[model samples]
Structure formats: structure tokens, C-alpha cells
Target: MKLRTLLAVFGVALALTGFTLVAAPGLASTITLDEAVLVFVGLLGVLQGVRVAIARSRTAYEQVETPDPEASQDLPTPGDEFDEMLATAGADRREREMRESVRNRLERAAVATIVRTEGCTEAEAKRRLESGEWTDDPYARAFFTGSVEGASLFDRIDLRRDNQSRYHRWAVHAASEITRRSEGFDA
Candidate 1:
């Protein structure tokens, strides 16, 4: 059996034994034998359930980092001006594309959230989302909290690698960028 299963079984067994001992001492209690057994089983189920829940709650997820395609490859020697220029342009294009993709993802999510939660028009929602004061709206606040938590950088990389979804990958990057910009603006 898996370690979690084994541990849960052991915990339930212990609870059952302990409760049985306390409830039916020398068979002289007011409670009948059947009632004692029922109580013991109930305690066992609860103990097992608690152990399983705790085990599941403790599980954590992590993202695996993939090397950037541009950065991973060796650059041209310093003397090769044309090669270097091309490389720089390519890197810049990649960076811009990444930024644009992330921005689009964030905008869509933020605007949708604002529109849905605030009963606002798309234009107003888009404006509010771009303004960066998302916490003013109750729905926006909860949405941001959930998005940031779910799209955490560390977890999203692996999620991307595992082909979880395009939106998820972009959401993680966008959330981080938005958070960074907001921090600077606040300061």
C-alpha cells in the first residue's frame, strides 16, 4: 500500500483500539456491545478521513524551468557584426512576442472579470483593468487573488511544459508582470 494509505489505516486502527478500550472497559458499561462497536467504527472512519485529508492538503506542486530558446544557443563571435545584429533582433522579437502574448492574456482575464462582476460595459471594464486599481472591485479583488495564487510562476512553468493550457501559461506570466508594475507604481 502507499505510504499515505498505510498511515491512514494505522491511524484508524489506533483510534478504534483506543476508543474501544475506553468505551467498553471489562464489558461493564451501560452501552451495549453493538453500540460500542458502532462507536469504534465511527471513530475509525473519522480518524481515517482526517488522515487522508491532511495528507492530500500537504501535497505541493512545482514547475520545471525550461531553458529559453534564444539564450540556450551560443551567440556569434564579437567580430561578426551582421550575425550579432541578427541575433539581437531575433531575441528582441521573441521578447516582444512574449510580452504581447502575456499582456493579451491578462487583459482578457481582467476585463472579463470586471465586466462580469461589476456589470460594467466592456469598454469600462477594459479601462478599469488597464488602470491597475483592480482591488477596488470585490470581484476583481477575489479574481486577482485566485489568479495570482493559481498562476504562480514556479508552478506555471511545469504547467506550460505539461501542455496544461495556453491561457494558464500566459496568465502566470501576465500576473507576475502586472504585480511587478503595480509595485513600482505604488512605490
Candidate 2:
């Protein structure tokens, strides 16, 4: 125990002596003590300046921006209005004005599609849509001709508001039918 304690004390003393020799001013290195002090003080001053700048920037950001409320907001796309109505139709479950808007848009879309694909007049397209001759899907035909008022009870029973309404389903079916007809005509 005594020998170990002595060795530890000797090691510490030797380390301190070496440190003193190396840390002494006017040493073997080319950089003098004055130049090292100036460099350290300069680094500290730069760090302090950076801290002050960051603090000032934080306060500057805390102030209110310009008076224009919409300056930071994104602009709506061209089709956003119609898309919002469609989304409302999908979420609300019960059909209302939004559903009507969706139906109206889809009806127009169906007529336009008929006009384009069948190369018929607008009046003939409307007649086709009204007579339920545009597509073979029964639900889609009912959607335009008002043959069926609402879907089955199961289609309207979305209590969680997660699933789309029956009207949305009919819309999707109608759109797919239109797309299919358009593709077939093109082919």
C-alpha cells in the first residue's frame, strides 16, 4: 500500500513539472504568449458578438409582420372551389347543396363527355343523360334521371364520417363510366 501511494504521488509531481515546463511563457514554440492572448480574446469577442446577434434576431422575429393577413397564406388553385364541394359531399354523408353541386357538375361532365365522345349535339347529349341512356351503370343512370332518390340503407350508414356518401360512390362510378366510354371512343 505504501509503495503504491508513493508511486502515485511521484507520477502526479512529474506530470505537474512537465506541464509547467510546457506552459511557461517564451517557450520553444514560435507563437509568443502575447499573440496567443490576443487570439484567445479575439475568439471570445467574436463569440460574444455572435451571441448578441442571435439574441437580437430572436427579438426581431417576435415582432408582428406586415398588416396584410393573406400575405403568408397560399392561393387557391383553379379547381379548388369545385373540389371543396366534392369533399364536403364525401364527408357529410347526408346529401345537401354540396351534393347537388356535385350532381350538377357530374351531370354537366356526363353531357359534355357524351358530346365529345359520341360527336353529338349538346341537346342530344342532355337528352341521352336525362333518358339514362348515357351509361349502363344503373346507379349512374339513377343519379341523373332521379329514378332512385338515395342509395340503399347500407350505403348511407357511415356513422364514423370516414367513408364517402352514396352520392360520391355514384359520382365515382359515373366518372369511371365516362372515362371508359372516352377511352373506347378514342380506340
TM-score of each: 0.26, 0.45
Give the alpha carbon lDDT tens digit for every residue of 1-187 in model 2.
Answer: 2445545755786577458658884453667679867865776566566666766777744566777565576889875786677778878867487788888788788888899998999999999998888877766777777665445656445422546665666666676787678777862
| lDDT assessment of candidate 2 | 0.72
Please list the residue runs of candidate 1 whose C-alpha ends up more than 4 Å from where it truly belongs after superposition: 1-94, 136-187
Task: Return the lDDT, model 1, position 161.
Answer: 67
Clashing pairs in 2: none
Per-candidate alpha-carbon RMSD to the true structure: 25.2, 16.0
Point out where model 2 deviates above 4 Å.
1-84, 93-95, 148-163
Question: In model 1, where is the ten-residue run with the lowest total lDDT?
Answer: 137-146
The 0-to-1 C-alpha lDDT of every candidate, in the order given, reads 0.55, 0.72
